[model samples]
Target chain A: MIAKLRQVMLVLAVAGLAVAAYLTYVHYAGVHPACTAGQSCIKVQTSQWSRLAGVPVALIGLLGYAAIMGSLFAPEGEESRLATLGLTLVGFGFSAYLTFRELFSIHAICEWCVSSAVIMTLLLACALARYLLAGGPAPESHSSRYSTGSSGRMSA
Target chain B: MASRTQQKAQARAQRVAEERAQAQRARRQSRLRILAGVVALAATVVAVAVAISAGSASSAPKTTSVAAKHVSATVNRLLGGIPESGNTLGSPHAKVTLTEFGDLKCPICRAFALGPEATLISKDVRAGKVKIVYRSLCTATCGGPQPGAFSTQQAAAMAAGLQGRAWYYIELFYHLQGDENTSYVNPGFLDGLARLVGGLHYGKWLHDRSSPQLAAAVSSDQRSAHALGFSGTPSVLVQGPRGARTIPYLGNYQTYESAIKAVEG
Candidate 1:
């Protein structure tokens, strides 16, 4: 089960990275996707809220995906599993906040953002399951516990 | 020999334990890889969706330029017998007057010209339902000759007005505007425009443009605009028949449909 869970996390991390990369590309290129039906794209893109702080929102998304991918390579143990779970949770929370902003505040939905939000939600669930289902940690190595039995036999 | 056998058994057990741990690690790694792949796939799908939607959304609106029609013969006939010197576009009996203080070169004024001003002209001015006056405020920066620049442009416009084509000339200038403050008011450009409007007595008009009376009239209009608190072109004032109420310049009516409806009512 732990193995399966790891695979799910790995997949989500890579997927997130790809989404972030594309969004970053669009942000810097200033080439909006052709919008015919709704003229709101330019309005929304040009709005002050399109950038958070100084960085483009799309670039932020790319960095987030990269962080998630990096978390996946940590050594397998109770600590690593917990760390992964925490990171996924954070990703999910941030994605939700951005989604809310898009829906209510910005009033324009970036489809790529929505998809990332969905994937992040799934990733969070998978990470939590791994943490709960996997027994806490691998048994500790038995190096210091006992000397050779051959030395003890002569005394007996 | 018994000891050796026992040692061999322990060694085998240790090897099995190592194999189990290795298998577990490998399994975990594989699972993580699979999860990563799934996420990457989903992200790709999202990116594609965004690209597709954006592509369709921006390709719809098309703006075209149409040659403006000449004023109706009826309008020309209405202006023909009226005295050319004073405000005469609307009813003399009208108590409340609405005047449009505008610059021929201002873009916002140009938009107003294309928008509610057009509606107001058709419904109120042409129908004599409301008295309307146009006060041309050709200030230096707005549309007048800059201090250092050759101002043949304003001269040409004033000349056109002398030929009784002021409104036509203004509209043409707005329609064919170049970059602002770029010295676009050259003689050749003015000549071309005058020719387009037909029969502009350029020499006579140019001579009339700088007349002291015309300059005074322009100044008076500018003062009136300032008194009314209009610092911009395309400012309009609508007053009731009794001159009891006045509405100052508001912005585009696109988002204020209700206000427009009430005003029209």
Candidate 2:
């Protein structure tokens, strides 16, 4: 079940990365993100909130999804699981904030941004479930460190 | 009877071992929950902090009274000698025309106008190598008494053009640009801007701004902008002997400077 959860997370992360990459591309390319819903994408993209700390938000999303993908590949252990949880939680929180801004402040919605947010939320759920599930398999690389066997719990 | 007693004793020991293992598992699960909670709390704090920082950074700076006093003089100095016939600036015979599709309320357009644009006007435009044209496009306009504040504000600028001071009015507008969400562009605000344009006739501007010709001019700008597939403000294009080419994004003065050089060549 834990392995299957990771596989789901990987697929979701890849989807998120593609969305972020496309947004980042359009941002730098100075072209509108392909949008069917009127000018919402352009309105959101050109808004004050589209950037954070002078860095484009799309690029930030790209880097974040990339980091989450990196955590998935880390050796399966408490550290790797925690890393995934922490990263996804952060992404989820930030994406939520952006969505709020989109609805209230910017008054426009970019479909790509909403899609990324959904992916982050799912990744968060998968990470949390993986973290709490016990007695699956020992960390492949850190088996000796577990000491409590397949429970992967610290004896202390 | 002795064998029965041994079996009972073994059963009691087995129960005690199972209970101890269960208690250990419960303790481990509790610890995992606490660790996860801490990690989540910390991540939330970080995310909120970053979001707040971004919000504050992007907030518009209040245009101070002190700055307001010098805006007219500053704009006049920047563009005093430049020719401004209608919406165009610089020599009419200049070989290259750099057209900017902009909205006064758009912050990015304001940034480009105040930054690289000043340099371009003083150097290239003054040098008679390039003529800059302003075409109005409403990417950012707030609700006001006028149903179409975009057309009204732009028409006011076009009205200033009647006296050959549209560039001055435009430069001054960018300098005094406020929060896009605020409805600050009204008759009073428009009059204030027109008054700052050195020698513009206020009564003439008032009458001519509502004319059908200027309204048509603003409409034409929107049509051309839409035809170019531009949905954002400050979409720059360079026209020369070769043809028209769009600059993908606004960069520094160097970016526009380079494009002009390429077009001129």
Candidate 3:
């Protein structure tokens, strides 16, 4: 479970990082993301909410995904588990907030934003699962981090 | 006695399994507690990041480029170079004549002027693909209680065309257009626009604007538009070898370019 979960985290981190990176480049390049007519993609990207304190929201997302990816690469320990959990939680929460703003306040949806949000949510789930099953594998099952079937209390 | 000993061994194994299950539950609970604490702390930090970024992100940027709808450096670079005769743009002898029946104050027409028309003139028209002729439908079925100033604005643009700056004046007007039927197109505004066009004889434009011929020219354009059975302002007549046909309004500028392309063929 531990090994498989780390692979899952890595896959999610890379995917989220890709989307955020693309958006960040687009924001800096000042290019529209091929929004069709009557679509709110353009409106959302060009909205005031697109930027944060003179920095494009895309850049912020990129940095966040980068941090998550970095944490995933670190050694599996209490500290690393905590780091991954914290970063993924923050990303997930912020992504949810941005999604809400786009659907409500902006009244439009950027496909890129939606993609990023989905990736963040998935990463959060994976990170949380890893953090919960953080302990080393049982002596009985050397390949698995978690015990299967019936479990008994540890004496110590 | 053997059966009793076997029962005792079974009880010991069951007790060990129960203990292990309880310990696993405890570990799961402890992990959740730690996870909750981490989430809470991270949530606070994330909230602060959002709050700090709120200053720039809250209010939408007012000066958005409006979808590249305005004049670009490319457009400016190509201005005043095209040949103009009366209200026509591009080579006078160009094979295709793209006539736009537009009122200066019509908002839809304004969109055309700002978007597709801007691109068409700069790109297609400049390349001698089509000659765009701007006709003023100053009256007749425009349906609004257009102030007399509307006609004056049209005539003023016509008068500027006499100085070979007709397209220049029209471009400038759309660039600085005011709200419809607002009586905003006064003599002073037109004069300022002419001055802004640069190298256009503003004094001569003022003098020529009063000419009965220029005023009559505007009336003639309106009569021509009405004679064509045009249903409204902001209509187009594309005249090419395929024959002249009305370019049906699609309420967009992109279609305008396609219409021109179809006509040129």
Candidate 4:
């Protein structure tokens, strides 16, 4: 279960990275995401909220995906698993916020933002399922100095 | 007992090695994350800043005002004091007369009015070298005044003229002119505009604007403009002691300057 979850996360992380990269390129090149016919994509992109703290939101997404990929490299243990789950949850939350802003506040839908939101949602769901099914990291095979007395016993 | 001790020592060494590897991986990850984040942040900032600055630079109000001032100065120097007649204001005896037919509701007319024409008036009219006559042509086809509404606006203009405020009303109308023919020409809007030009007797102006004589004058002007090949709201004819010649008075100064010089020559 744990291995399957990791693989899903790895795929999602890669996909997110790719989407983020495209978004970043568009931001720098001043390209509007593809819009439905006759829609005002330029209006949406030029609006104030398209950026956060003076940074293009697309670049922020890129950094987020990179961070998630970095966490994936952590050793298979309780701490690493929790880190992955936590990072995925944060990404889900931020993506949801941006999606809401695009729909209600901006009144313009950006196709790229929607794609990122969808990917983040899938990642969150998979991460949560893996967390539940795996229970916790497999018990450590060898004892160490940090294992005090009987507490070091491998329960699994 | 000795074998057990040796085994414990080897396990400790292995644990230390794993810890060291973990720490190295963590350091590398942290550095990579920081580098990626900084680059991403810088790129995003640069992109956003460039977009915003470009948008603002084109439409900046200050730049527009500065351009307006320069145009005003040039026109004032070139065409000052031609005469004043009815709605037309300029030096009465100036040998060279530049008659401009314009629609208040036309954007292009407004541009010419507020830009090059303003400069011409100050320079030629003030200096008594050239005369400028403005004949209102109600060409508000899309969003300007209706036929009746233009008569009212013209009447209001005539009333303002009676009060020695023709130029003032013309200026105010140019400044506050609304969309052509759209409901922007309603009585309320006109009233507000009249008040801005100092209240002309609305009743009298309304009556005089429909007068046969004013109608005839407007019709005659329209015929003259059409005969001179004017297809648009702003058709200018520069007539001097030299003779009357059509001048291309587009928005830019180069064409306008050449036309003025040609008329002067």
Best by lDDT: 2
Computed on C-alphas against the true complex, the DockQ of each candidate is 0.04, 0.20, 0.22, 0.03
Q: What is candidate 3's CA lDDT for residue A72?
A: 80
Model 1: lDDT of residue B169: 55
Highest TM-score among the candidates is held by which one?
A: 2
Lowest-sum lDDT 10-residue window in model 3 chain B: B59-68
What tens-digit string does per-residue lDDT give for candidate 1 at B1-265? 5588788867876886688678778868865665565556545644543444334322321112233224323234334333221333456654445677766554445545545555555555555555556675544244333532323344455556666676555556655554333455555555555655544576776577567666656668778988888675556666553333333433444322233333443
Segments of candidate 4 deviating more than 4 angstroms? A1-156, B1-83, B142-148, B198-207
- Chain A TM-score for candidate 4 is 0.79
Please provide TM-scores computed only on chain A for all of the candidate models, following their numbering: 0.76, 0.86, 0.83, 0.79
lDDT of 4: 0.61
Q: What level of docking quality does candidate 2 show?
A: incorrect
- Candidate 1: where is the Cα deviation over 4 Å? A1-156, B1-88, B91-96, B138-158, B198-200, B244-265
Please write out the lDDT profile of model 2 over residues B1-265, one tens digit for every residue: 4488657755765686577567668868776787668676857676675667565545443333566659878987888787779989999999999999988887668767866788899899999999999998877773322337888889899899889989888888888875566676778778888877789999999999998998899889989988988777778988888677786445567778778877785
Sorted by DockQ (best first), the order is 3, 2, 1, 4
Sort by TM-score, best first: what order?
Answer: 2, 3, 4, 1
Q: In model 3, which regions exceed 4 Å deviation?
A: A36-39, A135-156, B1-30, B53-265
For model 3, the DockQ equals 0.22
State the number of backbone clashes in model 4: 32
Candidate 2 regions off by >4 Å?
A134-156, B1-25, B39-43, B46-54, B57-60, B65-86, B98-101, B106-129, B137-139, B142-179, B184-265
Residue A125 Cα positional deviation in candidate 1, in Å, after optimal superposition: 25
